[model samples]
Structures are given as structure tokens and as C-alpha cells.
Target: MHRPAPTHAKHCCSLPSPCKECFLVSFARGGSWRPPPCPLAMGNTKWADAGQASAIAGRRRERLIPRSGPPVRSECLDGKRGETGSPHQLEGKTMKAVMYTNRRADRILQFTSDFPDVDWAVVWSPEEFENGVADADLVVLSNRICTPELGAALARGRTDRLRWVHFSSAGIERGVNMGLPRDIPVTTSARAKAPVCAEHAMMLLLASSRRIWEIRENQQRHYWARNELNFTMRSIEGQTLVLVGLGGIGAEVARKAKSFDMRVVAVTRGAAPTPDVDDTVPRRRMCEAFADADAVIVATASDPSSFRLIGSDAFAAMKETAYFINIARGEIVGESALISALRAGQIAGAALDVAEDEPLDPKSPLWDMENVIITPHVSAAGSTNDYFRLRALFAENLNRFRAGRPLDNLYHFDDGRALPATN
Candidate 1:
């Protein structure tokens, strides 16, 4: 039986399934909090102590301002193929898709409605997928569950029937870290959720720029620190924001940066010049852009080539007053280098949404730094519309796959990253 959509009201009290899932939503009401925002309200005030169970900063966390656009219509699954020209047509064959996820009820129901023709298997445990992969034609994986055993199973040809793998999130660094085979064509929901993550990047930038972390720390001690914050606070309007990638998330960040009257410089992998960027540079020349930037935002994808790209040399290139922001994978940065830079005042401050080692070890210096703002990988949260958009993309891609068309957001195995959609 299909669960009906929640009431289409301006404010919804309905919570998303998998409540503990990171990148979740939190809505606000007049003054009084509806439900407690994140689990951070518990005794653990330090982000590092919260470990893998960390949520976006509690009630005080900024909400994602809704995007101005028409709502996307959900595609009905009725054996009517998509009109998009596909390169790989399924002909009359039906594909078998196995999803290994903890989001059982809502996700399973949505997948069923979207791909009614395909054989569906929802494996909630690693054991289930280990036993079931041999017959699966497609597998949808999330970063959290891409364990070593699963990777070995997929790599060892346990699933000759598996033609493709789809990752739910933008970062496949975890899959790469798990030693998953790079041969299978993979796709990610990277493009679908760019706006949400970009908005988060801006949030961290603004919060760090305005010294929100210090204000909160002072608030806890009942100390009036206005004079101190005034010295630290800065405006974004005249600043230069250098984005590390010019992909969907970087493009959105550029667009929003323009609205604030900030100049946006981008470093991309030879992607065409995007509209909002003031200038573009190849990744090799990113250090030049960093030298002049007021804030260096890491929005690049993590891959074999990009691991530890922002080491001591990258930090040494930045202006002493400039802030460092990472909305991308933490491995893209050298944790020790960032800490050393922060301690030595090589950079004014740093804001990080992702950490090199998540749950970030309790002894990490970042947790104790007054100039740093640490969030537990929740930058992609609060996009209520993402579920609809993600499902729509998958359905459209499923149609394309059946038609042998190039899938959208196709992960390039050779490049070890998601390629820009061709369809």
C-alpha cells in the first residue's frame, strides 16, 4: 500500500523518515520550537563528541531559504518510456534493482512507484545485500553503508548481473575509500541537491564572517562581547569568494555570491565558463585565485586525484585575514595542515561542514578552537523539496537507462568522479 503525501501546508509538522539520517530538515515556528532541531541539544555540546550521530547545529541553525522556481512534477511509472534519446535501450527486458538502505518504508514505496516495471529488492542489512547482489541488475548505495565487505563483494564479481551503481549523495569518496570497483558506471544525486548545499556554503561563510561562533560562546557564559565581535565581524559584500569547483554546487554558490555583491572566482576542471562567476581558472592555477580571495570555499568533488589537495601549500598561499570554508569532503583538505594554519593564524578562521575523519576524534584541536566553526556534515540538510527532486531524477534516469540513453549525473569511473550530465 502506498503512503499518501503529507498535507501541503505552508508549515509541516511531519518529520522525514530515518529521523537520525544526516542532511535532514528542521523548520521553525513563531518563537516556540516545534520539535527540537538536532540531537545536539543533548549533553554533548562539543561537535566532535557527538560522533556520527551529529545533527546540524540545533534550533539556532539557519534554515535554507526556499528556491524561487516551479515545483517539479513527479513522473508516473506506466511503461511509457521517456522521450529523451538514450544510448542504451533495454528493448523488452526488465531490470532488477536492489536498494540497500535503512530508509525502508518511504524510500521503498517511492522507488516502487517510480520504477514499477523493474524487480525491486530492499536490503536493509549488509548481510542481505551480500546474499542478494548476484541477481541484482542495479544497486543504489548510500555513503554510510558502503562497507569493505560490500565493496569486495561488488569488486569480486559477486554480481555479474550488476550493470550500474547509483550513489545517493554527491561525495563518493567513501566508496572510493571502501575500495569499490571503478569499472561499473555509477551515477549520483549530486546535481539534484546542489542548491541546498550551496545555500549551506553561504550560511557557513556568513556565520564565520560575522563571528557567530564567538557570539554563541559568549552567550553561554553571559558575557557581553559586542566590542570583541565588532573587531572580528566583516561584511561579505565587498569580499572575494573563490569557489574550488564550477559544477552544480559551485555554480549555485557563485549565483548566490553575486547577489551579495561579492566577486566570484572559480577553479574548475576545464568546465565552460558559468554565468555568475567573475572569472575562471583551471584547478592547477587555483592558488592564484586563493591569494586574492577573502574566503576560499572548497566545493570540489573528492576523488583519487583530489585527496589532500588543500595541504600546507594551499593554506600558505591564502591571505592571513582570509577565512577558509569547506562544504566539500574533508579529505580534500589536510586536517593537520588546517589545524596548524589556524593555530599559527595563517588564516583568520575556518568553517567546516565535513571533517577528515567524521565523528571527528574527540581529541581533535578543531573542536577547541574559538576561531573555528565545526558542523557535522549537515550542510546538505533542510531541503524539503529534495525528496521529490531526487525521485524525479531517478525515475527519469531509469527511463533513460531502459532506453540505453546516457544517464544524468553519470559517475565517470575513469575520472573517479561524477561527470556533468550529458542528457
Candidate 2:
């Protein structure tokens, strides 16, 4: 009494657009049959048969954004999709993505080349993002633009179609504070700017070690400072350099440090012995690592646990002639303790590319200190290569998303909140 489903050959329909929806075709003996009016024409997206089996078993598509749960630091969330979740529904439809960046349009245009099928909306502010984000299936932006208000709006379902978020920065901690949804996957451009960041750290170390700033000042004054310069100028050949973090940047710093023939001792959370480092000190023994160091560099990722990780005790344990370099986040080093150390000669000097607050306060004593060197956090600049690399990464992730494959650079949160990037 039940009739079997019939398959029609060369099916045709009078729908307005080519939609990825199932069709019921009744075929006669000769394979000539009428294609039923597509139910998709009525705007009902619930598919019946063909779309059900599209989700692959191993491809987990859980949200990477955090939910409105009790204030929990967002962890790397990954889970398999349910039986009904199918990317096939998005195949024929114009997959729209909203990209927020202060970067140029040509770079964004390359994304269009990679995904010709997708419609991208370029925005620069949260207001712009909110305007067109309602229809977006994906959001690509810098970590700085991901404000808490924007995140809250997304969590409240302001954009039901959003599937993923990509940050154009290596620092995932900034994005973590945005309270992104737990179900949406968030990715960063990890390792993209490592080479440049490492170069900057080395530059700071070398400048501070050889008293380059002092030499330059003496030259400007037309004063012969050979005697004074020789007094403070130290040779890096046999000195011990302590690197606080062993992430991409820190690893590069280690490599460059070895080229100078300096002994490298890394302080990290159980980092494996890297090629350039001669010794390893666990984070538990950070103060111990600083004891005899000629220079200590902080390149760790910024997180709750990392805030003020280096303070009075760590500075007090260092040799009086030791130099402190921070190319990482500013808050990682205790500002007050560092100021005290610099004033009291607890350490020789300090080089900071980042500070407790950006554009350091005018009244701060660090500005006038002869031993301190401060640069406006521009360590990641001077490289167009990083931009191209990020473009390629974004394209790859886009393709992977469409193909139902897992993404790369999955930033997993740990109990420490600030997990070492080496992991």
C-alpha cells in the first residue's frame, strides 16, 4: 500500500534561485516526470532527506565563543555536530562573511578570490559590524575590535548565522576577555609575526647591553664618551640570557641569542629543551632563573596568571648589573616593583616595548630614567610578509571550513589561564 520514492533524471524547477534543497520528483517508466514545486520556495529551510547525512563523524563544529555562563575563562571548545547539522544547506546560498579590519581592501579582496562563492562585508568598527553582521555567516577581525559589548550582542543571538570568528593577532588573551560564544570557533594568526617580534626583542637587548642609546646621546652632544662608554658596555659573548617565555617569539629570540654565542636559559611552564637554549627553568623557579642572568627577557603571553608575574621578589633576586627586557605584555612585569628596582639600582636597566598602560603616563619617573629604554609597542611592524602569511592562513581556514575539516592553531586555555605557547 506504500509507494516507493522515485528518482527523476535531469530534474528542472522554476525556483527563483538555485537552492541546496531536496526535491521530490515522480518518474514515469521513460524517466520523464514533473519536479514538484520546491518547498524551499516558501522560505522554509527545514530539509527532509538529502541534507541529513552531510555532517562528518569526526568533524566537530561546536561554537568557540563563550556563553553567558558564570564568569569562566573560555577554554578551547570542540564538539561534534548533531545529526541535523549540515553545511550542505550553505553550499548554494551566497555564504556571507563580515570582515572588520583597519587594513587595506586589496588584502581583503584576496579572501574573495579564495572564496568566490562567499559574499563578504568589510567593516571597521563595532557599529559597522553590528549594522551588517546580522546577515553574516562569519566574522574576521583584529583582536582589538572584539569588545565585550560586541561579544554580548552576538551571544544574545544578534547574528544567528555567524559560524566562526578569526582574529588577526597572535595574542588570544585579548579576545578571551571579550566573552565570545563557547560554540563558535575562534582562531588567531599564531606564529605569523614571530620573526619580527623576536628581532625587536634582540634589538632591545643589544641596544641596552652596548649602551647604544647613551652612545647616540654622546654623539649628539659632540662629546668624546669613549671612557664612560667602555665603563658600561658589556660583551654578550659569554653572558647568560634568560627568556621568560618559549613561544614562537621567545623561540626565535633564543635562536638569535645563540648566534651571539650567549648562554640561553629559558623560563617557561615545563618547556621542552629547545635547540638554542642551554638550560631550562620551570615557571616555579623563575626567581632562581633570574639569579645570575645578565639579561632577562619577558616574552610570555598575557593572561590572568601572567599579570604581574614578575615583581619585587624576582627583581630583587637578579644581579645588580642585570638588564630586564619585556617585549611581551606590560602588566606581566610589576610596574611599581620595576620602578623601585630601577631607582634603587636593584637591576642595571630595563627595556620595555609594552607598558602597564599604553603611551606611558607623562608624570611617570621611567621616562626620565637614564637606564630605561621605552618604545611604543611597534614590535610587530616593518613586515609585509606577515600580512601575506595571514592572508594565506585565512584562506586555508576558509577552505577547511567549507570542506568540513578541523581548523589549525586551536588555542586551548589552561588552569593557569596563561598557558605557555610552547604547548
Candidate 3:
């Protein structure tokens, strides 16, 4: 279910600590419940309650530290700054950041108090957004709302003051294609969604192997079909699993698949071996890898090069008993060819979290296909933690930007694609 974007702008200055009424209201909205900050710590306007505030502040500060180490990119800094990891440089300077998001303004506004030196403007309506973009020193936005017009506005509004542009979501291909300025540094919250998405991929993998849909049908009919299921159900243990990409989500999936004792084969553009992958096959030799797999998963970034990358030829290379699972973009697969492959028994079954067309046509043949399980792009759902993780990443980057340090998950545009950050 999609909520309509808010029609007004909310500045952080007037925002208050979450109240009991706010909790009740959020709970009434069904699945929107997020534990508000401790009232004792945030109730006072100055947030002077040391005990609770100190504990929470410690956690927020920990999030700013990189898991590996601080990222370093000389090109991202100005020569005058001398690339030192210190907070003293930005002491008196006040920066302005304009953010466009679907999340409620009040919810996001609550965090702005931590960055008192930075002005925060959370805009949802188009009119407010255009004005906000023109004056912002930093911009944080969602790609879903970044249309061509908004992208052009961002390009025209770019000033020397604008240091960085951040996408709240991992995928920025759409925003890049929409004419985002090439000069500004762009970053994304790429790894934030990895854990949950990888879990979804594993869920689909398990469901496919055990023929979970058939088991559910038996349950619906009140039939004890243990004898029938034992003969048909397959175990994933010791089977070969092919991964098409080794980005954040793909790498996480590889780690999880290893726990199930599955042999992992990775098909990637790079020659380097991935962490848990048993074999590394070049992208051009993906068909060869497909032939040796019991199941194949697509987790590549969607770009012009990957559009319809998986089609009849790739499907023909797979074993008749192999399952196909795609937790990536649907445009990466040839829909008609996939349907034909399933009809011809080229593959046993498929589990998809995305489709070539979103809100897939109810009349589409894929919906009626017994060999296919379709989820409405909900692989990243059911997690409030992702929201906080993204907020933490944004806050950490803001701190980096203020300190003239290299940002995490920076997006490169050399190949006309939003390449994921190496760090």
C-alpha cells in the first residue's frame, strides 16, 4: 500500500519530542509504529537529560564510525582542507540541507536536533521542493520522486555551496537517467537494504526447493499429504547455486547460502573471487555457469547493459530441474522468454519479487502460472530497522561532509550508471 506524499514542508525548528498521543496515532495507522525517543531524554527543549541522552547519543556516535575504517578519497576534498579527520574545522559554519522523502515530516524532523549547526528542511510538495533545492548546501532525496523536471531543477540549482547529493535508497539508476548533474558528489545508502533483501532471496529459495505453495494448498484443503510431499520435495543441501552479481545484497546472499551447505558460483564482470563463492565465472561465460547450477539468482544492478540480459538463450542453458529466482530488477529479465521457458519446462519454477512492469497486470499469464510465485516487490518490507539504518547513514555522511571527509557509498557516473561504492 502506498501512502500519498505529504503536501507541506516541515522545518526542524518547530518540531517537538514525540508525545504519547503521537505513539497512539502511529499505532492506529497499522504498521507504522516506530518507538519514539525516550520522553525523559527529549522532553525538554534543550535535551539536557544526561543519562538517557548520553546512552542514545553513544549509539548514534557509534554509527558514525565505519565498520572497516574511515573511507578516503582525495578527489572528494578541497585542497585547502588538508584531509584531516577532525571536527574542529566546521565549528562555526552553518550548512543547509533540503530533503525530499515520503516519510512523515515530523518523524524525520526529530533527528535534526542532533545537527544543530545544520538547517534542515523536509519537503514533500513540489512547490516547496523547488525552492528548497535552490538554496540547499546539501540535498537528500528519493529516486522515486526525482522526475526529469526535478532533476533538471537540481542541475540548474547547483551552486558552489552544494557539496553533495544523497539518495535515501540504494538504487539511483532512475535518478541518474533523469539528468542529475554530473559535477556534484552523489551517495547512496546501499548496504542498508542488503540484509533484509538477502533474507527475502533466501526465503524464496527455500520456498521453491520445498514446493511451499503445494504444501500450502494441501493445508488449505485439510489434507495430510506428508507421503506425497516427501516424494516431491527437494533439499537445497549440496546443490549448486549461481549468483549473477556480487554487490552488497548478492554478497550477503552468498554468505547465507553457504550456511545451507550450497555450492556458490558467482558470475561477475571482475575476475576476483568473492568471499563465499566456490567458483568465479566471467560475465560472458554466465551460460556455462548456468548449466552447472541447481538454482540461479539474479542480483545485478539494472542498467542499459543488463536490460533483458536473461532471456531464452540463458534459460536454455539451465537444467530442466533448476529453479530461477530474481530479487533484482525485472527489466533485467525477458518476461516473455521466462514465461515460455517455464511453459516448456526449461526450468522447474521461478520466484520473483519484481516484474518487468510494476503493479503487474492482473491479467498477465505469469499470475496464473502454477510454476511461478510472485511477490509484489515487497522483499525490503517488514523492517523498521532499515529506516533507522538509512537515517544513521545520512547523519554519518552529513558529519563527513561537514568535516570535508570522503562520504560512504559514493556513486560514480563514468559509465552512465550509478556504480555502487567500493567501500
- Candidate 2 per-residue lDDT, tens place, 1-423, comes to 112222233222442221212211111000112334322232212223432332112342221111111111111113221111123346456677887776675354455443444577877656777787787778776665567866765565446677788777778666678776557766767666776898999999999999988988999999999989888898889999999988767877998899999999999876567888999988889999999799999988888878899999999999998999998898898899999999999999999999998789999999999889999899988864565446535544555566566665555555322222221
Candidates in order have lDDT scores of 0.69, 0.67, 0.69
Regions of model 3 farther than 4 Å from truth: 1-93, 105-114, 416-423
Please, what are the lDDT tens digits per residue for candidate 3 over residues 350-397?
A: 999999988888998999887788999988778645655565556556
The C-alpha stretches of model 1 lying farther than 4 A from their native spots are 1-93, 103-109, 156-159, 179-183, 221-227
Give the TM-scores of the predictions, in the order they appear: 0.76, 0.73, 0.76
- Model 1 lDDT-worst window of ten: 24-33
lDDT of 3: 0.69
lDDT of 1 by residue, 1-423 (tens): 112232224213333322221122121000112333222221211122112232332322222221112121222233343422123324344576788877754443465544555677787766778777777778887776777877776665445667788877777767877776566667887766777898999999999889898789899999999888888899999789999987768888998899899999998887777778889988789788899999999999888778898889889999998999999888899999999999999999999998998889989989999889888999878886566456556755665566566776777756665664443
Count of steric clashes across candidates, in order = 10, 13, 0
Q: Residue 292 of candidate 3: its Cα lDDT?
A: 93
